[model samples]
Target chain A: MSAAVLVTAVSDNPLEDNPLEQEKVSLLALVGELDYTNAERLQHDLQEAIGPEVCNLVIDLTDLSFCDSTGIQVFLTIRKITQDRGGSIALTNLQPRLEKLFHLTGLAPAFGIQPTVIDALKVFRARQSSS
Target chain B: MTGDHGQQWPIDEDLTALRERLFQHAAQAGMRGERLDDLLLAVNEAVINVLEHGGGDGTLSISQDDTYLTVDVTDAAGHLDVRHIPRKRPTGTVRGFGLWLMSQLCDEFTIQRIAGRSRVRLRMLLHRSPTGAASPDSVSGDPGPDESWARSEVRSSPANGAGAHVDITHSGGTAPSPQQS
Candidate 1:
């Protein structure tokens, strides 16, 4: 079968009482394959998920089987948008192959990558407290 | 040289069918896991390049041997300049990563302009034979003799300049022949 990209969203902190912890973090779980054919869809889904109100974002890629340069492009686009809106983005559960791709392209550092969703959330939380 | 393992199909607008076909062929040829994914991604990038810039459509060919899996994507537009493929685009750039990623994923990547067509060849090493001995089933089909034709109009390598030397040849105004570079 041809490759496909499937995305689902999980919200952990939708609303917080404290303004410091108020940053809404939406975790997007991606599966299947991400390539030129379906990267645009992923980008659209991501754009739709994060709005002017929703800020902090974490992409869970535990089940992602494949990703190409187009996929990486989507990540860059999202990062730019999130930064422009005064938000943060992180990625968690990257497979070894995907990690290698980021490393080869020298993007590992540019992206906020953690081992798990919790760790990614922690990163956002740490930034909130530090700010 | 064309082998029995080689197959070609027309490039479609979305390239979904092409990706599926290439995936199945690579899997049947013994590629699995990340390697298969890499091959698919590389071929997809090449095909996308053709569809987006080279022309609206092109042709894709898949072939394999015991040690290497090869794919060739050809387009009518000869606008691609291989030497200009950037290894990394400035951060936040959306385009220009397809060719770079293909070069990184495949063991060898070469682009040639022949008879007003842009042909991109990508080869991935299936497995390294420790003894340096060819597998008995490696040469399953007759690839025919290699014959020289018109010289390539332009040829370019990745920034790293890795892999074997590629030879570009066309047969009596027919389909282009495979070269081991």
Candidate 2:
């Protein structure tokens, strides 16, 4: 009955060994509920995907049905790590429930939130272009 | 849900089974959308607190009436200190959201420790009465005469967190202040 958190890498870069050859952006889609039981797993997956070269992280929560305080803690941890490395974390495709949670926790301003994955990517692209 | 008078589930070290049961029961009780999610999150957080800090195991008893659903989580460890309950959500730290979030999601939240066992009670308004107001009787945790099943589930022990006595009750609006602390 444990909720599964599936972290799928959506980026096209196939470079396995060379960090310089890989794209700087990492797009990860989180599927399933991220709660106390699976929050640590999701954090591990996200951390593993975010290497030194991958600064910008885009997380698609399209298929996520449930999240609690534990999930939020993990997201905050990842956001802090990403920000410290001069990268940004964007959350896309949030369900209305999650949006309400973000709003209630007063954490909506802590991360980049977009309506769609394309929009999230555009935000990262815009940030990159400006720099 | 309301169909079951007083269903009791054991809160184990692995909360997966308990969580699934609670989710399905809540969904069956007509809670939908954000309200349902809120209830689940609040209850899950309470259960997590029990497992993490309240001697590693507890009992979750769910009971409902026409206008409200009530969940009572009881654990042998009476570790909750009313004074330590955060009045506001903590900032710059990620670990303190459980109790605060539970308070924010439920219409009525209470923590009580009598003797040695601790009980965290959560009540969510199911719907407004026909007069467009919540039923007044729903405010009381007093179970009806016939619904004694939930009351029977609570057991007390003298050795678990002995001498700790606390009664912290919070009722009314569930919204926290707009500003984070």
Candidate 3:
């Protein structure tokens, strides 16, 4: 009935005003369920948010109550896009059930999950520094 | 065991109502927490599979017993092959996760074609609380390959496509009566 998923994005480093580096890191907090019914809409939203300049993505699932295989497919598609641009994606605040789904599908390693958004951002920073 | 304890819902172009009905029925059945979430997700995937691929219409029959809650989704499009569903998780990222997910979430998964309609049956073990109400248990994780299909049964006859009359009982689990005309 209502929107199945709500995507809220925040620029992690807004003060770094370089055009090429501006908004490269985005923190998307997902609220509500993501399933086949609204997977396409969420994919479109994520694609729009992940522009050419934007690279690393941190998805916060603190309020995400449910996710199906279709929902997982959306993240996989975004992961490929980010990886192709020499960037990575991290997932934060996964509920236990969602975490179990990721583990069951053997996608935890591919997504680089973290306990919190801050920890995920730190990992991205570490990766950038090392590279 | 009788008509008083079970319900059926039609799966057509609109699934919003079907989902709501499921949530209400499942919650009233005493299912809570992630276990409820798991059942909803699994059944949602099954219904969507029917709409997207199985001639766009079907029926959902839900019944529960002392130890298991069962949902049987049957569609007129008899194209699904239980053998074709991926047993192991697919290595690719984008597709091929829906059927696998259905199998993984439920305690027993089975598919059989009857009278030219394909039916996918999903059964989840009901954990009872101290007061005898069904509730979620602490068991959460991947059951691995061996455990996922612990009580699955797939019967297909060569002459009738995927239709084979196989006994649909597992340790006292009752067979859902055929609803086809």
Give the top-scoring candidate (DockQ).
2
**Candidate 1 error regions (>4 Å):** A1-4, A12-23, B14-16, B87-94, B130-181
lDDT of 3 by residue, B2-121 (tens): 235688877864455676788787787788776677678778889888877899778999886656677889998988745435555667644556776676666557776666878888
Give the candidate order by descending TM-score: 2, 3, 1
lDDT (Cα, tens digit) per residue for candidate 3, span A54-131: 678889999997777778989999999998988889998999878877876779999999998778877776777787
What is candidate 2's lDDT per residue for A1-131, written digit by digit as tens?
Answer: 36568888874532343242243677888888877777888888888877656668888899997778788989998988988888888998999878867775778888788898778766766777798
Candidate 2 achieves a global lDDT of 0.70
Q: What is the lDDT of residue B68 in candidate 3?
A: 66
- For candidate 2, lDDT tens digit of each residue in B1-181? 2335679877874566666777787777787766677778778889888877898778899987776678888888987633334565567665567776666666666666656877787776677456434668865665543232111121112221111122333332233333432
Best by TM-score: 2
Per-candidate Cα lDDT values, in order, are 0.69, 0.70, 0.70
Question: Cα deviation of B138 in candidate 1 (Å)?
Answer: 8.7
Evaluated on the second chain alone, the candidates' TM-scores are 0.69, 0.69, 0.67
Per-residue lDDT of model 1, residues A10-124, tens digit only: 6444223334235457778988877677778788887887765666778889998677777888998898887888887888899977886786566888789888887877778
Docking class for model 3 is acceptable
- Candidates 2 and 3: which is better by TM-score? 2
